[model samples]
Target: MHQEKFSKSTRTNKQVALHTDVVVVGGGLAGVCAAIASARSGAKVVLVQDRPVLGGNASSEVRLWALGATSHMGNNNRWSREGGLIDEIMLENLRANKEGNPLIFDAILLDKVVAETNITMLLNTAAYSVTKESANRIESVNAFCSQNSTYYSIFAPIFTDCSGDGIVAFNAGAAFRIGSEDKYEFNELLAPEKANSDLLGHSLFFYSKDAGTPVEYKAPAFAYSQDEIDAIPRSKNIGAKDSGCKFWWLEFGGILDTVHDTEEIKWELWKIVYGIWDYIKNSGKYEDVENLTLEWVGTVPGKRESRRFEGEYMITQHDIVEQKRFDDAISYGGWAIDLHPAEGVYSEKPACSQYHSKGVYQIPYRCFLSRDIENLYLGGRIISATHMAFGSTRVMITCAHGGQAIGEAAAMCAKLNVKPKALLAPKLMSELQNRLNGLGHGLAGIPLTKSDVLLKAEIQASSTLALAEFSQQDDWLSLAQSAAQLLPFTAGLAPTFTVQLSAQEATTLTCQLRVSIKPENYTPDLICKTIELDLHAGEQTVSLDFSEVELITQYGFVIFLANDKVQVRTSAQRVTGTMSVFNKVHKAVSNNGKQIAPPNSGVEEFEFWTPERRPMGQNIAMQITPALQSFAVSNLTNGHLRPWLGSNAWVADLSDKAPTLTLSWPEKQTLAGLRLYFDTDSDHALETVLMVHPEKRIPFCVSRYSIKLEDGTVLMTEGDNYQTLNTIYFKQTISTDKLIIELSHPAENVPASVFDIEVF
Candidate 1:
């Protein structure tokens, strides 16, 4: 090998020139996703992050929990988890760290980016300068890494601005709006009467730990007084165990510029945090906080709103509320229009104003590409949307989905050697949608029709379909002293309930069925039915048939395992429409020598857990029949829109035996692969605010299935699937005119639904 000269003749330190197919600025969830998506699609990518960590607000520095479609759970739009790369990250986190630890999640995100060979990550590098070849095309971006005191000039054919602040777009001279839009501009009721510079503001959160003993506290110089705390409307919401984020109302600098005044905003937030903590501990009002101490406080305030770049289409509040369908839709969002007052903590009103959508809304590809810059794309919170619309789409999961779309689009642009605007062509847009759908990305109303042999065939199913799972099983569950499983029940009468349990040793146990007076909080307050039993060491079934128990509200079944040796059986299969609740127990015993049970004393004391809630992956086992319905088999190839909770997919009637679906074509067609999209409760967002769901796969997913060609020719038999999308490629090409699919319910007497089926 020949070696060159050590130094250049002209300069001491020169800029490092790095070339890539695509350059992504910022390493937040959006940037990470963009880089990953691009790399996966055969593009050389360079991901530049200003911070050392990958997650932006979700990282340890900011400590904001990831939110997305789950934000609209109680607002009629349920089970709307952002699919694709975001889902992959969530599922990986659920498998590794179900506790939702930010540090562990940070590592998970970092590992995901680093694992991609085509992605070159430059942490601690900030992109500040943009080089454009023409008026509309960005040629390169210059970033400085202060850690090594090195300047990097990264050249790329395509660029994605996933930076939450839209730094790349701003520097590239892309047209963008800094604040709210006028109501008349977008015809949005939520928008201000006239355009304003007010923003959603920034926030910093802190966590507290129990010190086991009384801890003395001193107020800082800028600490807020008890009188000042009393001025706020929701001051009573704070508690000893409450985190700083819970007081999201503690925001500031909305009236000021969120970017230029960031430092000022951060300083003010710190003062507020210390003041809030001081009032809670030293005010002598909250005696329960005597043992708690501040464990960690965020230095960098997590930003909510900033520069929103202009694109071919600007999403408005009407699009979200009406749930508009777009022909070029690439991703979807379902979070309610959660708009907060500009006067954060100072405001006397509630923290936010929420407007829910009829259901999840589709985000079009037109919103991802910059209107003026041909080579530039926008993602994350900076996508093209009015302030009111951004309230829903700005969520991290939605941003992550947007990032994935732009990444895929960037890869396509680089491959085709065309500008992003070129992809807007009908044929190209369809190709992009098909590719995204094939990869399990969100495109609500758009069906996968490109080269889909199943789309051209006639379909028939064996029986009428069921919308939801109708089976119930008694499985094993470990019960804490203050734990209660919440299930949806009719309010009028107490029906016969059957529960099976097994004890390690002979023990006495009490089972109480209580009515949740506060359905919102899911508290087991009023006792409707109770049963006392002496459980044996082995398995035993207890049936309680109560007559005329006046149930006024939703029901919660609480099991009191007085003896630590007893364990109740819970359904191993996940029930999508129900939820469970566990009370926050500081100690096993109460002030008296009695074991603590749920609905202990206060209204906000219990931690409610819903079905598909993360961390607790499995649902509580109970004896009840789920409502069922019949669905068409043709819906299997009708695209990936779950309009109602269980409406879009092809639902089969409740059957213990396997049901068959047949696809017949007029003539033999060459087939190389097959793709199946199952109904795994796509609407049920499977991650939790504090805990991750234990299992990503639902009971309705086709765990066991077989496929055969015409004349009884075996194609694939006895296959298992656990993901939302399952793709199978045959080793050898198979030519067939007809295909038969046999599916079995994973649970007893349950129904299975096929969201989409494709033959390539």
Candidate 2:
């Protein structure tokens, strides 16, 4: 109906200018977390994402699962899930989309971003240029959206680059490295002997489904032929059942430039994907594939490695392996140094070489600040880490965890009217850590900030869990592989444990009491005592006495060596801060019982004692001579969230009916908000995609809860809660001298547990 007049040779699209406290580039999980954290911290945030939807690698387009410190629960880091905003996203995803439908995940992320009033999300907007106020500071970023034909000029004092390719940082003259570092540069044994351009590659995935009837497939001209497909060293791994990320090894373009060569990489990956489908359909190798049809295939490849910007301090291999402590520590990581072959799918070498640390390690705040650009925060995989350290920190969840820290720092900077590096001051750094910890971000060895208001109140629970026994159930676990029961110990002589066991034949069981060298860690590196028990053919009770050995307060592992002839009883009772781990193999993450590294690889060799996922992984049935009094009412005010040096949670006795925690003060106090931390079985890896979880809600999470006054007036009632952090803000401030929190057990067999309670 309307016609536009003719324009000059060059014409510009619609131009828009925006001003905000913080601007975050990229829409990956890391950037999403960064924007959310900043917005929640009272900063006006503008989140610029180049894609149509958020969750870069984790989006439906790429379809890679989001994982972090839990490492699929394939390592020794127990209760190691990254906390705060990332935890909320994963738990929410689990509750709404535990089946891991990529499309559903996309909706969840979009919902979370849009719900934040302080956040202005600009999707499909790519920040292509950077405008600097000075050589070291970025004044604004210039972005464009081709779909809308719009140009956006976003001005902010603080800019965070969560982009996987370091787009903004690159344009802003931020120092970055794109290749591996020399071994001697950082004295990193895991580094290459000489610096090289080799890096992890890009990968594409396809999904197939049964049509209930025969479906035919025809190969396009670009698809690889049988002779070409046969040339791949790992072509034998292909099967009819494999789909999506299960074929993560279907990678390419590592040797080529990952950033500039992305399109070329996508084409090669497509050729490989279509070629594989063609082989399955026509090569007559797979039988059941006759009814299978290609359901979905990735349009864009997921990039693993690209540009790594320079920060004030670069984490190295030794920092990870030795579990180095940083004064400015803000976050933690536990995934192994997983490196893929540069040759990708065509290489004869193993698909990946992974070396795990003994336990979780700390990441310092200096690693998030740009070395050259002031007011710039580096986030995601681009954070300052050497090639070796990046191997572990490059995972999506780990990046997102660090992204929360970056966002918080940016908010703090805006509030203080200073540059990002100014937060490195001891007092400011402590404040930053406290803020992150208050939000439930797990920092190794960092205690929660003491609340003076909460301290003045007297806390009492209906009944505290006593160190007694996990009642034996009908289920029995076979001892075909080594198994261990993780238990909390006091700072004295180890207690005696009596376990019920049945033997297929008379056998001798070797029991060892072990603890980690570091009390804060769960790895059983130190063997305190060993005992041998003789078992009969029939079921009998056996005692493992380690009373002679004195130990510090920590989690002790009562390990039973593998004896195929014996089986141990399991308990239906699920307790907080307790789990049974097995020395087994998880082929997905390449964990094969133990990690045996090559000599001089600078990697430590340790056995992987990981917990099994639920529906299984029941605690071993055992009775103690002296009840361990680790879980107490005082633990509620201990200023620690999760299971750290000890069980930092107050767990109610299993027999207590209508469990409750009461906080009483001498005088009436005004309360506007209350924050509660619940046990979400942090040991369980909540993978964002692919794997199916047993329960939509964590078995140990509080399903229903109510907050009431001493007069019995209900303040807040949560009927179905599945998150780790529950913040309740009253519609109006209430004044009360006493408050009661009534809780229901998440599961019949699982006791009610809470880490900490804060009132504001």
Candidate 3:
């Protein structure tokens, strides 16, 4: 295959053997994303990876579910990953593939990478070495393929090392740190007393399933006893099936060398897994269920902690716990500081600590690129950061975000043909921001528009926006108290990076959004330098301008308001309303006239009736009712309203003999027509069916009845269908003032749903 392919290329005789815009090494989540983003932006990209599949640690090898910080489905913040390329991929997988869950995930990643026009992925490819002649700019890379048993050469203008081990940067001559450093290095409160060999460790997670039959296992000698296995504690149970997998299982990292002792850890875990199962079935402590045994075991050990690269910025634990904000914040991680034991399971270090912040924290773009490597962009676990900080930033959701960040960075490098390091300045970063937003990657053009952002007069609760710092001190009473933060920020060492001015001339008030990517969430400090604005006993308009400021190190907007001491107000509009994000009405699909009774002979057909009111957003109701109903559904997602009685959209009640219009939507353009259902009930209930319309308003034709006999006599309508009240032959256009609905017509014979009517 190589010789045949080479002959074709040699005939063409291109002077440059291997040349491209960007070379992305490591076909993991971050690598694929970077390659796709760069290629989409008109850059030629070469994707190289040693692994067979693309999802990196979160792949079929380990079978762990994909998660992001802001993409959680339920109201619970436990599973949110800010919806992005990853979320879109998961949805696509759910729609198309129905193989086992792991295979489904693998297919999703493959489809995204292969379908892209600009990415050329080389699988089963390994990077033997990276030769960087400039120490700053990446010149080219050398890779070996096991499939062909041959070595090849590849050259690209820009390079990215998303290998999760920081291998690309390490080879690029970039400085990085691994494990805990001296506490003085970052002044982090969670740092160990001194630097050590400890890392967060890794796990090989596989679903525990028994295919319909229980298997008897011969317990291994090294397997942990039932007591010991149970002692591990099902501390973190996630996913729909409750897949028992501890992400921060750092025990192996401490008990054994994670990098060198991978095989040993696997050997030991295999023994422990079977022994635990044997004891569960034979121990007689619990009732045995059918097919209750380990279903699948992970072949690849999911690596949690690896190497770190040096970037333009370093996020710290203090930044998270303190709720710091930065101007260059390209992303935000909503998960708690889910740090496992720094010193393995049996060590002296605490197992974990809560990342209880005042609110969501932003991830600055500074952490995306290596400071030393001018053109090389890094992401995911390989992003530059100290070990203690990596603990909070290394989760899947944040890593996915890091993927997007570096992806955008690769795109910018190729588009401008400039070193990524040169783009770190705020001026160039704005352009990057525009690019990311365009691809639907960064915080640009959020579905919530500027007009969608509701500006208000006053907040009822005062301290909702104060810059209150929570350390071991302030209780996390804020989110429960008001769901808003009112932090009174302390100034960082600076020459006032921001200046805030109120509109009022008489009163003087000012605020400065300072620099400091730590303490206060590494969020740029918005310090109120002065409080002299127009609050003349009433409402007034005031604005603070930071448009002139050059740098915003972290992410998130600085909302500034002025008051005499303070005024009550509620600013910032939530994407969905206050009740709940699940206020949607599902339109039940109709069966082919099978479940519904036929309309009378005189009537053309029956259609379902419903209000055009949309469901109100975000709410939970145990019972559906008129006054307590929700109607905030989107324009396309069930904008029509259903009866508050129950989930039945427009069911025909078969209790009466007559089909009379208790309620029907008026074919009018007024709100009255749409809101009539608010006060409707069984009085407005249909004994039969109402005719559905194509417009927002539904027209329910009165149910008329007629039936023919074998003797040629018929009870017919005097309406448009016949000339006389009684007729033998059927004609056209039947009409009726009252509907002959099938009431008391046995519960089994009634048609519950209505769509459109058809006349034969």
Candidate 4:
């Protein structure tokens, strides 16, 4: 190669022009999901990411865990995992990289993107400019890749900005808000008394490992002095065993512009990180840190709040706290309204203030569409939400769930040859919701419609679960705190529940039968009945009969008040739609047993009844006088998935051998695909990082299954399944009058359960 002669003028970099149906900006979990969903929905997609890897805050560079509605299962929301593409990604990560290694997570995301043939992924490319066709619509986006010295001009009919900072929409002239709104503006009591410029800050994390010998560290010139470190109110929280996001409060630059001042924030965070490390190694405060060495430090800080674009509707604090239902509901969120102080690590105030809602609230499609730029779609933290509401919706997985909806909407827009606003029509909105729910995207209160074949078929199962008893096992748990067994009930007289208990001495146990004010919610806010039981020193059975009280069809909590002297028997058996919850606090999320908001704060006060993590959260051992027959084979055609008004899933009895479900139709029908929904224990929080899950595969998820025709010819078989949605497309259409699905129990104790089955 020869060098060119020096000239007075400069040469331009290589330029490339591309066209696609949908263009998704940013490669965070939200954008990654947006691109994948768009590609799966039959749209050509171009994914542009400024970083070298996907999963922005969740990437190795930042190393923040991807969390959403489940809120680490620290709140009242049960079976509340966000579904669709994000769920698939999390399950895949759990299968291959249960250790939650950041590097492994990055590879998994890359693998998922590359597997989608309809998607064109561009890494290390940042979109900096937008070209508008008119005053409202975007014609193309201009981006550059520093590594390749290339400029890319991508044109698309629809554009989705999943960038955390709303870069694309901002450049396209989209209206946005930068700071908290005034309390009177939206009548949101949680809002600041007056409009403020303060915002959540950016944070950096570091990891350490044992070196087995003394390791020395020296503070750099820019590092903070001991006095400066001492100024931080939470400096005492720093410990030798903690790493990564545990120090999420180690933030800075909230008082400044998060987007423009990111560099300044990074430098300050670095100074703090290195300074903290120096103190641990040389300050001689931490004895266990003698053999520890710094394993890694984040190169970039994880940004919390930035530019929030305006859409057709701006979700306010009321919508979240009141569990408002939207006519254009497309997705849902259950994480608490978590907000941090502007002073961050240096503040004397608590690290964060979080308030949880009574239940999961619905998010409308209108919030995802930009009001100013016609073709623009806002996603992630930049979605149309006020500062108070964004605190709950800004989490990565929640944003990813909304991103899937945006991607599907983009596909619909291209198909209909219309703008994002046009989807607001009632009929069109219904279509969008139907399409999203069909793909296993969880929308609160929206049930799937039965397929034509399922509508005409008669479903029968080999055996169905009758809630007769949970046999008492040797395992007995102490009543350290109040514990309750969540059980489904019919709209009639409450059944008699007999529980086995043992006491150190004679003790009186107070039992209360409670239900949520809303039937679909899990929070036990309404007391249905109460009973008093006397326990003996030895193991004895106590019967609680609420026969005098009539009840509506919903989940009833059989609560036993805390009595340290008594112990309740627990069964090892795991059920698909059953769990045991306790009234306790998860200090990690600021849940202090119960929430008591300040007067006129507009936030409701409620007790947090959360479940214990698995390998320990066993069901209570109890027997029903008249066995509850709710898990019928007919539930497969009931439209609803998951546990709603009742157990919508068809669960086979644990005693049944070779469990099978048969669907017979009057006439032969052509079938090309079959979709099965299994129970993945949605209540369990499958956190994407830091926290280690008790099991790689959800204990209730079916591990092996087979589909066959009436003639006993096997159509397909999945041997190592570990997901909620299983779609099996046949190589060729088969005409059959009857279909038989043979299932294997996920475990010996756990029964075989399925939410819904669709044939097309």
Candidate 5:
């Protein structure tokens, strides 16, 4: 008899100990974004993902759609595209993965993370253990890879828990909650009446391919029969045309813990899925799926709910539904409060309940940092929020935004040698916002007051540009009703209104500048002044000089006479908080690819209104300085990106002549390089495949340009450009007090526009 004994020893060379400024757990979109944000901010980030691929649920394994503020433009929130790392990801996906192919998307995310110089990506590494310096701070995370048989000990100044399950935080004893919270606890209307451990459950989606011939499907003995799934509402929504996330409701395990009983839930979902396919193929019920066969099914379920790490601020349903503005808000969400029934697909009810907001809402900095844990920052689905609030925030793009915000904060904290809580300070928070905006992450309500050269410089432009334009359907309505557009203005600022008017024939138009006595109600109260204009049949910019009128409140109402002799400019492109009011024209008007018609008259004013074609967000077409700042060339120097919603490069008047922008400074500053941010139709989130997409490109981007500096230096002469941010580095230090930029017509032959320009 021989006794065999196996000796265990560390792969002396395989044992790896790596130190970084930020260590991010989980390689989903959130973790990847967090790592990228931190790395871009000059931190060495070590990204650890348990899966072989990135994107988590959005990967090929789960094949979930990466949705965010766009939310398929389902309801009130329109033209809202996520920015920051997520926007970058969407842009890359649209460029490379137009067909919504998961494999290609996986490669895009992987390539993005790898492209960052300071990011070290560790794939197939699962964090199972944590080392703590104190009860409230994590020292390091220990992870193991079964594939490579390697043990990794990663150390960092800050740790981001983007793991959907919050595994690292759980192991590190970070404060957390599981399942739904009672309504009474958070004063949330959507919460369950009583606190319970029931979760939103897991979903297993399947993709099918169509063969030339019929494909037969057989059900396993354990699969459900037709009668077994009678309670499900599949009959109403299911169809052969559906693929990818179409079968997302084929879920179960709400009664069981999502994490504790994952395998059991997965098996049940599999049986249900196969059973459904069998029924469709053999039952002779769904003729459309006759040639379809199951090509792939997600074994690891795409989870909807799980452990949530507690943070200093717990986002509630009220904050989301009411569109609450938080001073510390770092990111925004507008997917709607989508809550699935606890019984999941088997509930015989709608898969989910959705309540949309009027606009995007904020997610504060406190939602990312752990309430008690000093170094831990929560991200993705694990961010501190009541289950009711998570319904909207759980979407991948919003999660990615949160990840980016936390990553930037973590990097700043590491640089400053401070804790995650330190960023909550007002000064640091403002700095964080500036950094985010500087990186072109569009936070809707946050303004780029700092780092905006136009704010301090004496700015002038080639022309007072109109970001959007509207056509006149009919000039005369034959009604006495009035019309006005609600504009959000600062109380102290003297706002100017540039009304673009069009007429069928030469006619006169009268408009009264009215300020709402009740700021919230938009009722035309005291008439500040009345302006009469004589206009031709073509488009013209009529200046309603409200610069003399100091707005008493944030909103100043502009009332128009219902003569209908001339039509005012209106577009579907909606400004965030501003709206257009038509007393009688209740018919919905389309603007910016969205419907802008609000319902009939309300007792109070401003309740039902549409957005003008002018602009929204920081920029408006009305040509108000410090108010509608979009008309200035300095908008090119401001840090905002994603040109739609009036956040864009200043567009010159449409003419045969090219427009020139000159940058003049007081001192002769030596500049090394020039960064040009051009408009690339950031509004549409251009997809790689435009089979069903509306716009291919924004058409306003500057595709061709010429630049000449002082002292006979021709820099970037006649350069053809197609990117969002184009950098032209000068070979030598060009010492000058002024530089000139000539933007020629784009390839599309539209007006030349530039979003931003920077010299360093």
Candidate 6:
């Protein structure tokens, strides 16, 4: 085992190296993001991390799932988020591991940190000291690695301490505090009955598997009940060997001593962890399953409480419980004030409560910077906050947002050659807030240079700018990944966000985000989505998928279940398919034509149509032609449907007796055209339906021409035919909303079992 320890060093005074504008200590999520922000803003940066990987708790070290305000339902279907480096991480994961339990989270974090050219990362390094010429300026930062015991210096104008532990801040001569201040500090309702229980806890999480066969295991000699176990009431039933997760075994983080007792707590944690398994197998809980054992043991203990330094804005519990919003709020969090009760130390039930506000609450940027220290900035759990406020804001994922905010601020300071506190000023604070608002997709653009006045600009080649602005009191993490990108580009927050494009370059382009719960949308390759954006033409606020990412990895999903969020790299040999369900009907395509009912095979499924908002009739028409079955195209949002909502993968059923159709193909086959027939069964509200060919197998039903039924007129071909080979088109030309398609044209020999169709 590689024991991570600092070696003996006698040298206190050492020469420091100078480079870059900003130096971020602690390469966790916040540090990584801050580095990216600084580097992207055209400032050089050197990122130092004690550990080898990035992402802090979200990294592989702890392996806790990414938890923010997520709209996820077990990793299925489609979703979106605000884009940035986090979006990039998510997109990479989608490209590598599509299904849930995204395993490559560590690699994804590392890749982003390494990909940027302006940022230099120093791994396996620790920040030992921060030398300052004055409180207003950081002269140098010294880092040491145990591997070499040599101190390396990094000098920068601004320094951000994203080291959740607040080690750097303390070294920088910044006054810091640990534990709770007063019960009224944050005005939290669930604070300690009287005084605050300044205790913060951590857990040793592990993954367990069920053993099919019974196995006996002996406990260690010291594995006996003590005051620790006696105090807290154990369910005695929480541990189940068959269960895949086993955090219930967490028995650390009580009063003996927070830091000094770490090793002892680790020892006690081990006993309870293995003891539960011992009872499971010996106690007969393992009798039902097959082979079972520990799959993974927690490496870095999940620390819930730690040191916190006073920041420019000391976020109070009242700010959270009362839903206090700030005009300069850069990020939002509203997960609820969940207080885990410590039952062992005080001999009382552990405190656990769920508190909700009328709406989301915004976290101000001031909470990220040091108020006393001139050049110091704090991120993650150690940011300036009262005990109760930290209780709500200290979550890893939410803290990551704090990390991102500070990182960006650090970048902004470096680029502007200003201090982080400068950002707290009204003009700068509002600008940063506007930038965040744009990134959140809540508000658009920096509120600089009013839109209406831009139309009368004296400059030549000026387009009529109708920019209007609206701001939402964003307090939900659901939109955390939303609007952080606009400033560096749209507004002058980062200033370098301005791009000088060639005249030939299309103004319209797809903007991919970096991190998201759903990774399918983000891509290293610039996704060539049609551009219709009228920037500088209109000033309007709209919610969009600009920062949302989608991806798929080919080898990750062994057998993809419907609605599973997936990502895949396009391969020439790859085969794909789609399926949809409607009111009382299911539709798909096949080699010959659209199927009346989809084949009852793994390749396809059938669903009967039901009444809906658009329209419905006795049946609906489905079309499959030679034109479909083989094609390479960017992923589309609407091309298929399923019995359940957001099912990315779907099975199709083609049945003429009912409003259902299906299509099938061996591989990529050349198809001429495709024809879809509709009955509007009983509705006309349906306007358009898009088609996607997952299999890339062309449909052979329609020859080289198309047929249009517009105005009840049959035509040899409907509209324009493009370079589409395997896939073809089907639009509602009948001026009606719904349709019933079938493969009754037996002469075409089309089986109607194609699986690529989506109606949105």
Whole-model Cα lDDT of every candidate shown, in order: 0.72, 0.91, 0.47, 0.90, 0.70, 0.45
Please report the candidate that would top lDDT against the real structure: 2
Model 4 lowest lDDT segment of ten? 444-453
Q: lDDT score, residue 95, model 5? A: 53
Expressed as tens digits, the lDDT of each residue in 1-760 for candidate 5 is 9884675863343679999999999988899889999998899999999999998988887888777765553333434667767876776575555567788888988899989989988889999999999998899999988788889999998999998999889999988888888878877766767998877888888877898687778788988886665546654566666665767777678888888889999998888887777776777667677788888877788998889888899998888866788999999897767767777876876776565555678899999888888999999999999888888899888898888999999999999999989888999999998778666677765755443333333445566454333222223222134567555454565555665666777877787776645343333456788888787887777777666776654455676776656656544333323445554432211112223322331101122223222222112224444444344465565555543334345667555385878777776777787766665543343322112343323345576776777565677774544456566888787777777887776642256777666666
**What's the TM-score of every candidate structure?**
0.74, 0.99, 0.57, 0.99, 0.79, 0.56
Per-residue alpha-carbon lDDT of candidate 3 for residues 403-455, written as tens digits (9 for 90 to 100): 76667777777778778776778877766664554333424112211111111
Residue-wise C-alpha lDDT for candidate 6, range 275-331, written one tens digit per residue: 655555455544553356656666676566667888778887668645565767776
For model 4, how does the per-residue alpha-carbon lDDT over 540-654 read when each residue is reduced to its tens digit?
8889898887888889899998899999999988887888999998998788889889789899988889999978888999998788877888888776778887888899999
Clashes of each: 18, 0, 71, 0, 14, 127
lDDT measured at residue 680 in model 5 versus the true structure, 0 to 100: 52
What is the TM-score of candidate 1? 0.74
Off by over 4 Å in 5: 1-14, 449-459, 466-630, 634-649, 680-696, 717-732, 744-750
**Candidate 4: pairs in clash:** none
Candidate 5 similarity to native, TM-score: 0.79
By summed lDDT, the worst window of 10 consecutive residues in model 6 runs over 680-689
lDDT of 4: 0.90
lDDT of 2 by residue, 611-643 (tens): 888889999999987888889888887778888
Question: Residue 102 error for model 4, in Å?
Answer: 1.0
